[model samples]
Each structure stands twice: as C-alpha cells, then as structure tokens.
Target: MSGLRDLTKTKGDRLAYTATSSSTVNRRKRSFILSGLVALFILVAWLSGYMIDPSHLSTHLELRNLPPSLVHPFGTDWLGRDMFSRTSKGLGLSIQVGLLASACSCFIAAALGLAAALGRTADAVVSWLIDLFLSVPHLVSLILISFVFGGGMKGIIIGIAFTHWPSLARIIRAEVMQLRSAEYVLISRKLGKSRWWVASRHIFPHLLPQLLVGLLLLFPHAILHEAAVTFIGLGLSPHQPAIGIILSESMRYLSTGMWWLAFFPGICLLLVVRSFDTVGEHLRILLDPRRSQE
Candidate 1:
C-alpha cells in the first residue's frame, strides 16, 4: 500500500512539473510575439520617415494650418508642411540618434563594468565615477554636455552616450562581480586560464543578454532627451523636421488654434517611446532567468 501511495505521489509531481513547463513556454511565446509586433511597428515608422523625400516635407502655403482630414491625416502646419511627413521624419531621426547613442553608451558601460572586475582599485574608481554622474540630474547634465559640444546631432549623441551609461554600468559591474566568484570561473582560473580568456569566454557570454536588454531600455531615454534638447535649440537643426523643432515651432501657432501641429506629432513620439519601452520590458522578461520561468 505504501509503495502504491509513493507511486501516485511521483506521478502527481510529474504532472505538476509538466503543467508548469507548458505555462512557461506559452508565456515565452506570447512575449516573443508582442516584441516582434512592436519591433515591426518601429521599423515601419523609421523606414517611412527615411524613405520620404525632403520635397514632400516642403512648405505649401495653400495647405497651411489645415485641420486633419482624409487627404492630410495629421493635418498641416503653419508653414503648410504635412505634419505626417514631418513627424515621421522626426521620429526616424530620433530613432537613429537613439540607436547610435545607446550603442555607444552600452559599449562604455560594458567596458567599465568589465574593468571593474579587474581589481579593488578599478572597481572603486568606476564606482566613484558612476556615483558622480548619478549625482547630477540627467537633463541638466545633458544640456551642459550638449552646450559644450555645440549642440548639433553630434553633440546630442555624445551627450546622451556619456550621460546614460552610469546606471547600466553599475548593473554590469554587479553582474561581473558575481560572475567572478562563480564556480566555473574559479575552476577556469585554477586550470591556469588567463583572466582575459576566462572573461571573454565565460563572463562576456553571460553578459550579452543583459547588455542587449540594457541597450533597448536606453533607447526611450535617449530619444526623449534628444527631442528635449532639440526642442530647446540644443539638438538637431531647426530646419530638420525634428519632433522637438516641430513642437517648438507649433507653440507660437497653438494660440492661433492649429492643434494638429503639436497633437499628432506628440502622440507619435509617445507611441514610439512607449513601443521601445515595451520591447525592452518584454526582452527583459525573456532574458531574465528568474522571470523567464514565471
């Protein structure tokens, strides 16, 4: 009887484990689908903006200040520019800038993070730098850095790259610190493998998922900051159909009641930003071992 009871318990446990595994697989599938859809939307938006001709964005006096209509989906700006084209172009530019800035930032974070694993002195210095950067407000530092770099696309990208890495770096540092004490790493060292070899082979592979997620997470902040700086005349040129410039120019005409000028572009920016954020979050869940199973 006791043997039969043990057999029943084992079967129940197996069934429970199978059910949990199925649930985890289903959750991962849903996350992948959602991430893919969001990424597709972003790619389409970027391509639409990139493929549009500058002439299409040219001012048309006849269409100036027109309200949203079937012909002009986002309506027309005071200069008679199609708000749709302008917003698309601006978002594309923002995405481009964000991509470049985020990549650079990730590189910085990864380097510093790995360096922090080298020694106590290196860790201390990296920690201090991280703290120092974190102490200042992001916007203020971004503005100052943009001002120092003379506030163009280059300046904006550089400013964002420099400013955004501290937090991610700290995360990477902690991860690397833990990884250093991992049993496999210790065994590698004991086997006379060079630190560089162990790091590149073992540590870096472990860090890749974290880095990818961090890069995606950084995109929204980079795009928003770029827009903010450009809005205040410290980012992309005003002549460019940047979202910031579009919104900034729209402010004067808002009193004149041309609402679509700011409204559509603002909504588009928010959607794009939110899409990036969603993708990052989804990727985080997919990549995080603890969350991936849940």
Candidate 2:
C-alpha cells in the first residue's frame, strides 16, 4: 500500500509540473501575440502618413475649423487641413525623429559604456562626463542644444541624441563592469585572446539584449521631448505639421472653444508613445530568462 501511495504521489507531481509548463507556454504565446499587434498598429499608423501625398494635407480655407464629420473625420483645423492627415503625418514625423534620436543615443551609450568598462581611467572620465550631462535639467539642455543647432529637424535630433545617453550609458557601464569580472572573461583574457575578439564574441552577445531594450525605452522620451521642444518654438518650424506645431498653433483658438485641435493629436501622440513603451516592456519580459520560465 505504501509503494502504491508513493507511486500515486509521483504521478500527481508530474501532472502538476506538466500543467504549470503548459500554462507558462500559453502565457508567453499570448504575450508575443499582443506585442505583435502593438507593433502592427504603430506600423500602420506611420505608413498612413508616410505613404500619403503631401498635397492631401494642404489647407482649404472653406472647410476650416469644421467639427468632426464624415467628410473630415478628425475635423478640419483652423487652416482647413484634414486633422486626420495632419495627425498622421505628425505622428510619422515623431516616429522618424524618435527612431533616429533613440538609435543615436543608444549608440553613444553603448560606446561610452564599453569604454568606461575598459579601464579605471576610462571609467572615471566617462562617468564624470555622464554626471556632468545629467546634472543639467534635460529639457533646458535640449533647448540650449537645439537653439545652438539653429532649431530645426537637425537641431532636435542632435539635441535629443546628445542629452539622452547618460542614464543608459551608466546602466550599460555597470553591466559591462559585472560581465568584465566573469570567469569566462578572465579565462579568455588569460588565454591571450585579443580584447576585441572577446568583446565581439562574448561581451557583445550579452550586451545586445540590454542595448535593444534601452533603445526602445528611449523612443517615447525622444518623441515627447521633440514635441515639447517644438511646442516651445525651439525644436521644429511652425511650417511643419508636427504634433508640437499643431498643438502650439491650436493654443491661439482654444479660448474660442476649438478643443478638437489639441484633443485628437494629443490622444494620438499619447497612444503612439504608450505603444512603444509597451513594446519595450513586453520585450524585456520575454527576454528575461527567469520570467520566461515562470
């Protein structure tokens, strides 16, 4: 009877393990599917603007400031431009700028971080530089940089790229420092492997995950900062139908109760930013081995 009881308990444990494994797999599958949908939504939105002819977004004074209707889905702005088209274009522009700035920032962060982990001197110098940048308020620094660069697309991109790297650099530096002390790293060094060789083979593979997460995480901040700077008239020109420009122009008529001018674009911007953030978070969870197991 005892043997039979022991066997029964073992079978129950196996069944529980199988059930847990199946549950985890299902959760992971759902997570990936959700992430894909978010990605598709962002892609479609960007394409909607990018693929459309610029002439379609032109002003038509006759239809100006019309409230939301079937003819003008998101309503016409004060200039009679289609709010839908304008919002879509603005969003696409934001995504473009965000992508460029985020990539540049991530590149800067990765380079500085790897350098900092190279030696004590390099580490101290890079750390000091990071701190110096971080000391200044980000928005102020961004505006100053943009102003110096003449306040346009180039200015916004450069400003965001330069200002956003310090935090991510510090994180990467710490990660590299930890990886530098690992047994395999020491072994490779002792085996007379060139630093570059070990770095490319061992260190880089380990760092790729962190680098990607940092890049995606930076996207929303880049977009928001670009919009803010533009709104303040230090980022992009008013001629551009950027979300910032749209919102800034909308302010003039807000007293007249034209709320839709700001409402639709604001919501679109929020959704785009949130979508990027969600993608980054989901990627982080999916890539985390410990969480994946659970």
Best candidate, TM-score:
2
- Residue 58 alpha-carbon offset, candidate 1, angstroms: 0.9
User: After TM-score superposition, what is the CA distance of residue 130 in candidate 1 from its true location, in Å?
Assistant: 0.6
Instruction: Give me candidate 1's TM-score against the actual structure.
Output: 0.94
lDDT of 2 by residue, 1-294 (tens): 999999999999999999999988888888799899999999998888787678769878988989988977789888888888999999998898999999999999988988875679999999999999999999999999988999899999999999999999999988888988999999999999977777678777888899998998999999999999999888888888899999999999889888889999999999999999998988888898788886
User: RMSD of each candidate?
Assistant: 1.8, 1.3
Give one digit per residue, the lDDT tens place, for model 1 in 104-176: 9999999999888777898999999999999999999999998899888999999999999999999999999
- The TM-score obtained by model 2 is 0.96
Model 2 is weakest, by summed lDDT over 10 consecutive residues, at: 195-204
Predicted structure 2: lDDT: 0.90
